[model samples]
Target: MKKAFFIVSVLFYVNSYSQSESKKAKILEMISLTGVDKIGVQMMDNIMNSFRNRDNSIPDDFWIEVKKEVNSEELINLYVPIYDKYYTEEDLENLVKFYKSPTGKKVTSIMPQMMNESMEIGKKWGQELAQKVIQKLENRK
Candidate 1:
């Protein structure tokens, strides 16, 4: 009886592991099909570019090594758990389909520029709010 139970437990564990691996692979496929991983890689490149711009001491080889170490596969592995948490296999499939569409492709291409402009707008709004707060404080005093 004990041996039977052990066998059953082992089989269950193997099955569970297989399912997890299958899900992870599907999620990775969706990530690739949607160019989500490419976006992450591009963001990393932009960060590396900023470092290169801010300091001349770093060597070109340094950037190359950094890029190699922090490649798309690494980023995708890091993000797998987050994707798994938020999306099921069906959801990922739908997302992949959407991202392959023209509108989705446009959005993916423009996201970085949109983010930069949005940050500038947010900063200006924050500064305006801060000045108003300062004026109110002065008036109270």
Candidate 2:
């Protein structure tokens, strides 16, 4: 009986591990289909460009080497758990299907531009609100 229990436990552990790995792979596929991986790489490139702009002493070869060392998979792996926490396997599968469709492709293509414009608008709104707050505080004083 003890041996049978041990075998069952081992089988359960293996099955659970296999399911977890399968879920992780699905999450990765969804991320790739949505172009999030490319966005991460683009963000890295923008940060590197900022660093290069701030200090001209950094050699081009150094930046090149740094880029080579940077693995987008590591970033994607970080995303996997966060996605897994919020989305079920079925949700991820549906998302992957949507992202493969034409409408989804259009959305993926335009999202970065929309996000940038929204951020700019938000910044301007924030600055205006800050000015208003400052004026009100001065009047109160």
Candidate 3:
């Protein structure tokens, strides 16, 4: 009976490990379909540009080497856990399916533009709110 229990436990562990690996692969596919991996690289580029702007003394070779060292895979791997925490394996599978569809492709393509425009609008709205608050404070004085 003890030997049978041990065998059962080993099978359960192997099955669970296999499922975990499958889930991780699905998570990677979902992330790639969403274009978040590309976005992560873009963000890294933006940060490097900002750094270059601040210090022009840095050599081009140094920046080139730095850029080469930046790995989007690491960023993508970080995202996997967050996604795994919030989404079930089934949810990831559904999302992967959607992202492969035409509408999902369109959404991924246009999302960056929409987000940029939204940020501009939000900035303007925030400035207006700030002015109003200042005006109200002045009136109180």
Candidate 4:
């Protein structure tokens, strides 16, 4: 009886691990299909370029090394668990299908620009709010 139970437990554990791995693979593929990793790389490059433009004190070689250290594969691995936390394999499969469609392609093409513009808007908004707060403080004093 003990031997039978141990065999069954081992088989169950293997099957469960296999399913989990399969789901993780599917989610990773879905993330790839959405062009998310490409966008992340582009964002990193843009930030590095902006920093280089603003500050000549930092050498180009240093930024190059930083980019190498924070490469896309590592970022993707860090991101996979977050996706898995929020989405099931079925959700990922649906997302993969949507991303493969024409509208999805359009969204992917435009998303980076949209994000950049949104960031600019947020920064401007925050600066204005900070100015207002400073003015209020000055008036109070």
lDDT of 1 by residue, 46-135 (tens): 999999999999999998988878757877899899999998777877777887889878887787789899999999999999999999
lDDT of each: 0.86, 0.93, 0.94, 0.88
- Clash pairs, candidate 2, are none
lDDT of 3 by residue, 1-141 (tens): 999999999999999999899999999999889998899989998999999999999999999999899888999999999998999999999999999999999999999999999999999999999999999999999
Which pairs of residues collide in candidate 1? none
Write down the TM-score for model 4: 0.74
**Clashes within 3 Å, all models in order:** 0, 0, 0, 0
Residues 8-114, candidate 4: write the lDDT tens digits.
99999999999889888987887787787787898899999999999999987899799888868878888888998999878888888888899888888888789
Which window of 10 residues has the lowest lDDT sum in candidate 3?
30-39
Where does candidate 1 have its weakest 10-residue lDDT segment?
A: 28-37
TM-scores of all candidate predictions against the true structure: 0.73, 0.91, 0.94, 0.74
Over 4 Å off, model 2:
none
How far residue 131's Cα lies from its native spot in candidate 1, in Å, is 1.5
